[model samples]
Target: MSNVTRYLCAAAYLDSGFRDKVLAELLFDQFRAIPPSYGGFDLMPVIYHCRRSRMMLVVRDALITGFFVIGCFMAPLSTFGWLWTLVPFALLTVDGIRRGPLIVRALIWFWACYSVFSLIFLAIMTALIPAAAYLFASGLPFSGLYGSGSTGSVLQQFLIPVVTLGIALVYRIAIYLTLVGSLKPGAPEPIIATTHPRLARRLDYIRRAQWGNVTMYANEDAFMGAGRIQRNWSIAVELDRVRESHKPSRRADPVDIDPVELHAFVRGRLIEMRDRVLRPNEGIQRLDIGDHVVTRGIFTVADGQRDRAAGAHPMIDRNGLPRFQATAEEIAAIARHPQGGVRYYQRVTINNAGQEIRDLDGNLVAPAEDQEALTSAFIYLAVEGRMLYTQFVVTVLPPAHDHYHVVDSLPTMTSGRVTWEALKVLKLQLLRDVLAAPVRVVRTAVESVRQSAMTPNPRDHIVYPYGARLSVRELGASESLQTHIQVLDVGKYIKMIEQRLTEAVLDFLEERKVETGAYRMQAAGITVSAGNGGTVNVPMAFGEHASATVNGLRPGT
Candidate 1:
């Protein structure tokens, strides 16, 4: 089977209609290159002309209509021929009215109104002239309204229609000129004079690695809505283009890029991101450290001294005899021992400072402090092909910022069940701690005393004690306190994090060696700041490494 047919069959699995169309086009060469035409005339040029002159569509309609009127009088064919001529004019007029610019449409409407008024005025004048002539003077030059072959009479007869048509023609010319000035196509894309195969190859590798798909926003609605800014990240792919007028998907020729320069760009961007996009405390909030342990293992290099000491030595026996009888398996086992013969390494907690944190009570706090303490964290990186992937596990713990107000409602309870409804009533009574405290306290006390057999004076009851303390055992059972914590603005932190990462990526691309063409490149990423559930995509580009360079050419050369 041909490549086109195979492609069609593969697509058939997804869509039958598309497959059929492709197959048909392949089978019939005529379908592959079908020209657009109507009634033996090519319509493509006409279509292009219309598109190119969209603003002056009104002129086309007016001209067509004027020609139709003239043709209807001049045609020698049947009445039907004259009517048929009106069809295209009618369609053009409707299109021009609907699609033309405001100014053009306005001019068309003015011409139409003037034409109608002229026709009406001509009819009125023709009738009034004869009546006036008969009443005033019977044998004047215009005695019968417009007499016998005189220039004055001829001018009087056709003045309105001629003047109206003249004005319409003048307006059409003005519309044409306006369209030419406004709708010219933009300049063509510039050709790259030089090629950097290494740079191009590296770029392709980065694209395949999906470095651009970084998460940057945690809550877009809250972030964008609060700021009153709306943005689209997909268009970011077009940002690297030097020319703003080009379409978003247009590709430019590859340009030369230097390895040393690209490295500097990447390094600079990493630093910028560290300082600006990622907050001083944002990543700290995401640290993986727990109470006194680093949940994620700490990674460090092994010491050369330890590696040497851990290596296995040849076996020696007494009397200077070498034990050479050991089996190959035993020797191999000794050499690859899980820990004995392995390189030396150590594990330690991931902390910036050795100082311990303390609470207000002077008690030792957890290794992972509150949001404020999480201002910095470690960045883990992995290299695959030409791409670098960064990952970090962040730990966030909500702080206690709420006040507790315990209320004793034991006095309100009697020998009845403590249902949810009864609890709600007692809650309201406790909440009324400010106004009319004494009155409500007294009333409730008396009511309670009457219901029960206890002989306690109602006047002695106290709801809120200022300088004295009064204990009521009945109300003591309803003690409760409300605690609230301050809400952390995670949106702001996410925004900052995204900005820092983007800046880092840009800095990576902006160095001298890389020779970035990203005059307006916009970096975008998802803000995966929500627990282990967050996701983000970030597009990135960095120049070839110096080690990959050969002879005189750069790494990507």
Candidate 2:
């Protein structure tokens, strides 16, 4: 077409299908090696034209009633012309790239190339079809027979289609060999760049292991969703790309994986995968579609550790290990022993209060005097390649801050049914403590009462017994002179325990406050001395009595 004609076509496109059709062609050119006639154009002008068209908001009506038809019905059309699939793919590829996964760039390229080629083949068929029809046209000299008497022979007619089909086969093979992970043996595979050091390491080994596939997700959610916080591990994978493509039967018999060992094995597999892609000698990898996955990604290092710490270790004697104190290596060792393949890991984020928490009730996490301590117990549940969950427990010990006592444990779960429900159980104990704390001691003629109860743990088979005893000190006495006791039990407690080694602290405060109040009141002309003893004096008749009582004061004064 002439330049003027083309410009006119472009201008009119805002109100027609020309714009979309042209853009589709341009996208095809960007991704495929098709000629310009097939939509190749410099990007600048194409981008400009696209912006203009979008602003106009000119909608073009499709030949079909629906604005979108996702090509499933195009199978019948395939017999007529395989080009239908290709055209839609080119358009879809352009749209997808403008707003979708660029990682699938190669797949789109494959689609564009194959579609363009299909179009070419169909065009050839269209041309030959006309010529063939002309020969067998009605009333032609050879119309009486299957073919009109033309220069072409019966062999030539059948031969043309076969040759075209063979060309199509070759086209498909060339694209696959060049674009897929088929690197010549001894040739190095081009490594995929990733920001994470761990990911990069995995990729290097994936290539070395000759696995043809490797995918990585830096954040928790991309193609998958883990969580939004760093509390969750970043995800990654290295596998045989060809095997993935073949849609091989899902992993038979779970492959035993020691998360630590797989952590190493993954590095090897990624290196091999990269090498095969970069350097294929008739293809560096010998992987086929039906082959099982010899490699996969790695996650949950901390989870495994946490699980073992929460008493999930298989071999170690349950009684021997310290509560929630197992180290990472110890946990990793348990899974590695005896060759029963299992792999998982766990991480922790500890927030410790200044002093050991004997008890807590919101603002203050107090210091326990002796055997009490405080801590957050986190558990990670990771099994095989899936099912991830996290559990949390806060432990409170004594004021010495030396050792952690299992005073309270609370459990929480994330992702799925978690193995760390033990955390929740601890919280329940704490709640019970606060609800019934300070077992009341009252002055009674009868002997003091002592009470105790036993608590049981589901994850641990230990019985927690709490004891409380009340006794009265004898001195002298009026009915009111003896001590009075009040019982306390605070439940739903956040946890706080305070200790003060002093006598009648509140009574002392009351006497001091009354003396101060009397001094202030007298300076304004009111009664007796500003206080020598625990009592404040007052005058009688005009104001008040001149006698005073000690250690007793009304709260309002």
Candidate 3:
């Protein structure tokens, strides 16, 4: 419940596309759940924000309509009678539309632009029409159509507003239908938790899962879409059973090793490193050991069938979830026939000391127990045949932008601040709203119709390469790490994980009775090169023409 999470919730309330993608698009009907990888943060707060905003809109719209009706009744008594009523009506209407769906908000903008141009044209015509009529009546014989007072008053008082409203209605319906018809079928329904109890439960489950478990993903990058890659390096070494001698001798057989056992041994050592930091408040905030599988991407049953026909692994279960973890038999088989699509990793997440976000009233916005860390580092280790592969990656998750955190700074009901704030907002927006009401009404109506007619399907129609790609946390994260301390922590954790991983692998190799002369040499070279911010090319044999290149910090920098 950091400010990043709060900002994301506010963003979901404002942007329908983002809300639908996180709450609906990533869900699987069979499991009735969102994939762990895609849903990396809490979602209940987001749902709450959306529902609250919708309710507020309803109240605001009702107030605006009431005032508008009163204004219409008072129009005959005074020349500017409707002008007083327009203030509150327009103000409320503008606020309501701003909190509405993104599509409607965008349409309102276009309509406002068009209305401005139309009003200017009508104003010029209103002035010219009366002058032209006077000149014609004085110069020519006919005086029938030369009454300037009545005509000018009629045009100014009635025609301008009437024409603007008329154009808004026509334009709204046209754009609404075009956008609605173009929408993809089977889109996710609006997340109305009260109206849809089942969706609310699903959201709760996703929130709990994010907190209680480590989500998995099958992708090309060691840690894809996590955040910026702060640091990364890999090391590979050839293995042999016989000890090296100064004189030439017969070649010995290669050592037989279980890749699974080797992976477990290294993983256990990394876990021990995590265990050494017993005080959770002192060192790493989170440490998880899990199999990090690599695949082209998550695919559906249809994709699996297509791949099966092409004589390749389908990579999915009958339930349509991706086969992220391999079975013991599958692992053993892959170890015997080594490939690139499977890897095991140890993830270490470190918490950096940063200032917490506070509201305008100076209250902490995030909960005490649920403040998520912004930095995470990953260690990938795999033993394939005679070559051992190890990679270390660091990613930083920055806080969301300032604007999206407006929800935290809004006034509350205590001390009558809400009412006072509302009055102030009305005063500021009254004039602008007077001119924007017609366009707002047209846009709101169109949006309402679209929502009612096109009810979204709960079940998503997922296709290959169309499933969820980016994570919600990553999507809302800032462009880079926020502070100098965060950057320092990134380097600290990378080096820590790297030291533990290297020691674990070297020990495991020696315990297997394998020659470590070449491995030691390569390790020393890699350490020196990395310390100096350079690259080390280590030639490793996997299948044929396979080589591994270890880079320092990043490939180029």
Candidate 4:
């Protein structure tokens, strides 16, 4: 009794200061009283917040108990006195009932003892209560005892306790706590308030888990937080009510993506079962495939650079002049039949492994050239694009066996449920009548990084030459199939990287002696014309080209 009475008086005397100290002490005494932390001791704000919260709790408890004592004194007189007693009593009861922070609820419990003692003392004072027995009995009052008495005499003494209890009870009836509970944040909530009620059923995920319901997916620490919150909400929603997904999720089977090439158009981009996709690199001035993310962007490379050569002959010159002389090289590159036209073959194939090939006879077929030959090829061969564009010529030639009985046009191959066994079993023979030397091996694309002011054109391509140890023209870069892969084409950058690949390759090729075996050499749009007319010019692309090749070019064939 002495200890509790002194504590109440001490609380009232020290008020704010003592309450804070008590809270600080309580937090240390009980580990669970402290809120959960993110474990960043480096963050002062978090530490301060925790300290402040605990202090507030302690102070609230102290002040409420003090007021409860005062309310006990006032209860004998008026209704307002009950408000004081009831407010603090209800506060303590609710804190305890709700399982508030452990230590805080304990302190509130201690306050309840104060009210109980007041009631016990009043009970002892009433004649109905055995005063001598009460004095001899179990415990001291929560409130202090001033003196002792007989039952009849105790009644007068308890008059004050009786009024205090009534006031406290009445006040508690008038007020109640509206909000106080756990803080579970960022959980996905039902969008029930949305204008389109039908939409909530699709978007809302009920969280059933203790923290949340949604399944979180992440290997990284920071991003995992978002996943955790999402998982919580997913668990919250009523899963039974959610509609089944309209389309099958793409991640079901990864093997299906391998056949994507079979369906994509020649030079077309394709995405796989992962739902991953790609786009041109925005870092460079000229559009380029910068990000090499797998599962997508496999077809992201461009087939060829844009041609910028001056047209040799036009139907009519834009100037008031007639033009006639045809650029012989350009003309020769194109094969014209007596009909003055060309016959091209195109095909597309779809491969579905282990699955029965649906007969899309002619439906999935596409061809260019003679209608009958194209149709037959489409009807027979596997029509695939990347294979045609990269692995084989888009147009089939002689001796490449057609799938079935010979036809006048082209042929291709498709995989229905192609197996490892199926590929090795088949080897189509070729007729050797027509053959040619290969020219160039396409290199990965590069981009220039020259500022606009420095290079007039930001798209100026930069190619570093190992043999010459210098840079060259845009068309030369294109012809070499090299790309300038940055926003600017800086000379220093060109100088630094140009020699990198060259020296490695030159050092290799120089180690081997030259041989004449029908070698095909490609130029950087650079050439010395062998015109029958005898006039020839080194292509404009030859500035650093002649230099770049000096070391590799043999003195005499």
Candidate 5:
């Protein structure tokens, strides 16, 4: 047996009362932790890379198109007649190429049709003009048709320019139609949340795993230190209950069900999950499967034993036995049975190597299995509110697999869970240095050094690039002074995660064939609305019902 197995077995044999606890602590202490990572650090880097790659492609096409257009314009700008007519064709091709593939194909078809029709039109004009001139010169024309022989030649010359203009107009119309059609959104590549394929695949696996009854808790005091008097913000989420509420009913459509409740439910879970995953014991465990490494978190009992006292539902395996160890009697009975506890434990296994041991009555005794677990579902929560927005900006190298939950952005293993808090943290960290650099430099010059000529004026403009060069006059001298008082931009992250989470939840519902309808899905956080009189956006029931006047005026009125 492996060293880990031997150690676990030895520990289990020491004392049954503290056996599981001791083993878990040993595993947790020895195993590494994987700090969470996203998009090879965070999403911004990946986005920047994608944008750079796509822009490079566009630049390549633009250069080629520009050269083609210039070549076509050469003749038109100089000779300025029949051959100059090809300028529109060149312009259309260039426009198509710049707009991307869909428009390019449209422009190609337009060119093909224009080529055929323009040739036919020119051919007919060529024959008709000359024939008409010949008839007029032969003196068979009436007075109005041709006053003199030279008149026919002048009229024939006018037809060529007119034909060129008509063809150009037709080509323009075709190109315009194609451009309009291509203006709509194209089939975009799927939003890749991460570049790690193994992580992504594990997310899918967890999504399919039994998570209905899986409950997750928060790591209380993760933000605020412990032993401080705080409001009862502790919140808990029973995913099974939340999911069961959405089950199909003969009386109602799933869409009609106020999605606000669903969003609220999920938002709480997401917040708790984030807090859990960021902490020491509540995070994920690294599991090595074949050649790939993935994260897996057990959301019930951290140990193999089920928490029956917590009302955890029993899990039944494929072998028609309880998935977890429930009672000692049941295990003893299974041991004495013919199957011999083959499917009794999910995490434990004892290899007897064909050596049979007999009990006091000469009954065959099954070998005991000692399970080595490095993951836990025991969470620490102490908040009743959903996470609206938190702005934490810290950038550090991702830790090893034994140090933290490395593969997952969110700590929970359940599919479709939100990582809004983590996302906000990443985004804040990415922009932190860039946003604070100027302030820091100015502060250091003015406050820290006390000798520099650097003076920040509120009226001064801060230049930032947007498309081309654009300047915003929003910089202030005392901006750095108020940096500590800055409010978190939680609404943006909340809205973003809410949208993604809503889609995911709806997709899951659709697969279950639930009837859906358009419903208001609001983010459960501090909501700010336009034109409010200090309106707090929590549940309306949390209103300030008690009022008192300390002075002549009502306090908190």
Candidate 6:
């Protein structure tokens, strides 16, 4: 398995709920759109792994059931008939008892241990009491009850199986511990590919299909997981003609500049920042203009076609994938409109080295020296109601959690070591594989059935707001900046992007013959406040909720 796949699998193994969510939302929810993952991580391999694990559970269940049936039949003919019957029941009882509330499970385990101790105590006293009586008295007191064919004989018969079962249980536990110890990340890649090449190919196909699509759901903040908001401020300056004192009549004339043209100019300037970078690896990795549209939910084919005909087309392509771009006219219209549902943004993505890069097939494309981190700045420009509006929201996408990176440091095992470890675990694992099979079978079946039943044509039902709201990359990302360098980089990129954005807006205003006094003052204040680590709050004309403020410190600090 690739590093990315290993991290994903380790994540799944560590967190069952996250694993189930990935399967349910991404793999099983056929109708829901799968969101595009940013920060150079592929989510498809994780989906494939979860699916494969589920299948393995089914196979394990089948083997266990087969063994159980054979044991039941052999119980009548074998000398260890009682053992066969007791083993399965013992496994089931133990498995069932382990689950439920934590406190209850603990109490149950305590009671079981206490009961076993009591039985051992009684057995020792029965033998010792009879021996003492024989030594003290001529005829053994209670000899009939304690003799070989009576209590003593019964105790021996009972204790023999109990002791044997205890030893077997200990051996089984050792096997389990060995199996767990042998479980290093990336160990399952070869087995998965060797066992299921066709499934692996299918996953690749799915990954390619969904790679670029921006899966959106209601109320999903597209900016979420891009990292903490490092800077959020907007400037709206009135579009007033520069007063020519000698030719005052020109002031009455409206400023003649199209919002589309202005937006294009700003976008070009931002894109040019990439070309100006002196260091390729240290500079922006991605720079482009993208339209981010928030809608009620995904459109059905009929709804999509109708919207297309009506000229208010949905922001999805024919294949039902998000088209993160709109026509110039559409952008101008949305910008001019007072409501805030859609906007065009110039996104700058700066990827720091020391992060694993993987291909669509989960193959390693780039190796890492250290943890990977991404810093992105989104700049939105709009001209509305004879005022120029410019906004910047900078975010940091931190590296994946350290636990996920454990795969990179896994010990290298020689073929002999691998074989020996497997052999050591094989016997006990086989027993457990059969004994715990029923529980696995039932759990897997219930989950499979639940997912299948829940799958529905979203259009057929009344539209509910709730839908799959998950991003695997975001889910896997570390909660905060991993290192001091990441913090420094985030601040550096934010400043660079902000500087470019400020220059672009100023140049646009100057070319349009708009007065720049107010804009320059606001920009100066923002820059100074941000530099001094003071909060900079901008009054948003749109509404109170639209207003944003930035704390003085660098993001992820």
- lDDT by residue for model 4 (166-260), tens: 33322222111100011111112112243554323211211111122111111222111111111100001111111124322222212111112
Output the worst ten-in-a-row residue range by lDDT, candidate 3.
178-187
Q: What stretches of model 3 exceed 4 Å from their correct place?
A: 1-4, 13-40, 51-225, 241-251, 277-285, 298-344, 353-373, 403-463, 525-556
Q: TM-scores of all models? A: 0.19, 0.15, 0.58, 0.15, 0.18, 0.65
Error of 5 at 209 (Å): 36
Residues 1-557 of candidate 1 have per-residue lDDT tens digits of 21111111222222323333432322211101111111111212222222223323334334444543453454313212323322333333465555978776676556545644554455456545555666467554445543443335435444433433444344434432322222222211112221666434422322221211111121221111011111112212222233233333223542233322333343344444334455343333231211111111111222232243332122221211112133434423432332332111110012122234567787878563222111122222222223233332222212111110011122233323223323343332222221122343455456547645533221233211111011111011112111122112333333444354445544553432223243123232232233564443333343565121111112211
User: What's the lDDT for all of these models?
Assistant: 0.29, 0.27, 0.51, 0.23, 0.29, 0.56
The candidate that wins on lDDT is: 6
Q: Identify the runs in model 6 with alpha carbons over 4 angstroms from their true place.
A: 1-6, 61-109, 115-215, 241-254, 277-313, 316-341, 354-370, 411-440, 462-468, 527-557
The stretch of ten residues in a row with the least summed lDDT in candidate 6 is: 74-83
Name the lDDT of candidate 6.
Answer: 0.56
Candidate 1 Cα outliers beyond 4 Å, as residue runs: 1-307, 312-378, 381-383, 397-490, 512-557
What is the lDDT, from 0 to 100, of the residue 331 in candidate 6? Answer: 58
TM-score, predicted candidate 3 vs. hidden true structure: 0.58
Candidate with better lDDT, 1 vs 6:
6
lDDT of 2 by residue, 415-434 (tens): 12222332232332222222
- Report residue 444 deviation for candidate 2 (angstroms): 14
The digit string of per-residue lDDT tens for model 3 on 1-557 reads: 44455666666544545665554334432232223332134555555554454444444444445445544553232213334334443533665666878887666656555545554555556555666677676784445344665466545545434543344333333322322322112222234445566555555555554442223343334454356666666666666544545332224556666666776777787777556666543434355555444444544424344235332234544434444445566545544445555444455554443334567797888643323335556665555665666666766666565546444444223324433433453443444444455455567688668756754432243434422354666666667665665555565666777777778777887776666665665555554444555444333434467554546544444
C-alpha lDDT (0 to 100) for residue 345 of candidate 5: 14
